[model samples]
Target: ELLLTTYAFCYHFQSDDPLIKLVEDYKWIDFFDFHWRLGIDGLSLGPILLTGLITTLATLVAWPVTRDSRLFHFFMLAMYSGQIGSFSSRDLLLFFIIWEYQWNLIIHT
Candidate 1:
C-alpha cells in the first residue's frame, strides 16, 4: 500500500504546482497569531519519498520477526505518520507537534 502510494506521489508530482497547500484555516487556532497550515513542495519531495521508502523497507524487513511484532509495527507506523506529517506541515506549531510525537515514538520503541 505504501509502495503504491509512494509511486503515485512520485508519478503525480508536478513541478508547476510544486507548492501544494493541503490545509489553511483561520479557525484552527492562533498560536502567536499563526494558523494551522499543511503543504508540500519540491523542497519536501525528497523527505517524503525517503520517509516512505525507508519505512516500507523497514516494515518488510521486520515482517517475519515474532517478538512483540504487533507493538513494533504499531510504533513504526506511528513514527511514519508523524514523519510524514512533519514533512508536509507548513505551520511551525504543527511541525513541532509532530516532531515531538516522533521523538516520543523513537524513545519508546
Candidate 2:
C-alpha cells in the first residue's frame, strides 16, 4: 500500500500534466449514468497519502492476531479499498457508494 502510494505520488508529480483520470462508463441502467470514474489530483492526494500511512501503521500494529487472521486482513483490505475509492472517485454516486460501503464494513466489524 505504501509502495503504491509512493508510486502514485511520483507519477502524479513527475508528469508535466499530472492529471490522471480513468473513466469506464457502463450504462447498466436506462436512466442514470453509471460511470466508474477515478482520478488523482492535488486535493485528493493528501487523503490518499494519509490513509496509506494510517493503514500501514494499523497493519503493523495489528500483526499479532490470534484467530480469524484471514478475516481480519480481509476487513482491513476492504476498508482500505473503500477509503481509496472514496478519495479518488470522480463521480458523486461512486463516492457515496464507497463511503456507504466503508461505513457498513466498519459497522459489521
Candidate 3:
C-alpha cells in the first residue's frame, strides 16, 4: 500500500493536469444525486500519501495484536480505504459517504 502510494505520488508529480481516474453516478432517489468519482491532484495527493504512510506504520506497530487480529486488520484496511476515498473522491456525496464510513469504523474499533 505504501509502495502504491509512493508510485501515485510520483505519477501525480509527473502529470501536468489533475488526474480524474473514475466518474460514475448511482441514482437511488429522484431528489438526490450521488456520483462516485475519484481523482488525484496536488491538493489531495499529500493527504493520500500521508494516510498510506500512517496506516502502514500502524499495521507494523500493531503486529503484536493477538485478539481478533484478522478482524482488526480488516477494519484498519477498510478505514484506510475510506480515508483514501475521502481524499480522492470528486463528488460531494461520495466524499460524505466515505467520511461517514471512516467515522463509523473508527467508532467501532
**Candidate with the larger TM-score of 1 and 3:** 3
Instruction: Quote the RMSD, in angstroms, for model 2.
Output: 2.4
What residue pairs are clashing in model 3? none
lDDT of 3 by residue, 1-109 (tens): 9997787567545446665543344554556654556777668767888999999999999999999999989988998999988888877777888899889888876
lDDT of 1 by residue, 9-99 (tens): 7677675774673435554654467666776777887888888889988999888989898888888888888888898888788789889
Query: CA lDDT of each candidate?
Result: 0.77, 0.81, 0.79
Superposed on all Cα atoms, the candidates' RMSDs to the truth, in angstroms, are 2.7, 2.4, 2.8
Q: Model 1 residue 43 lDDT?
A: 83
Q: How many residue pairs of model 2 clash at the backbone?
A: 0
Q: Candidate 3, overall lDDT?
A: 0.79
The TM-score measured for candidate 3 stands at 0.80
Q: What's the C-alpha lDDT at position 5 in model 3? A: 76
The TM-score ranking, best first, is 2, 3, 1
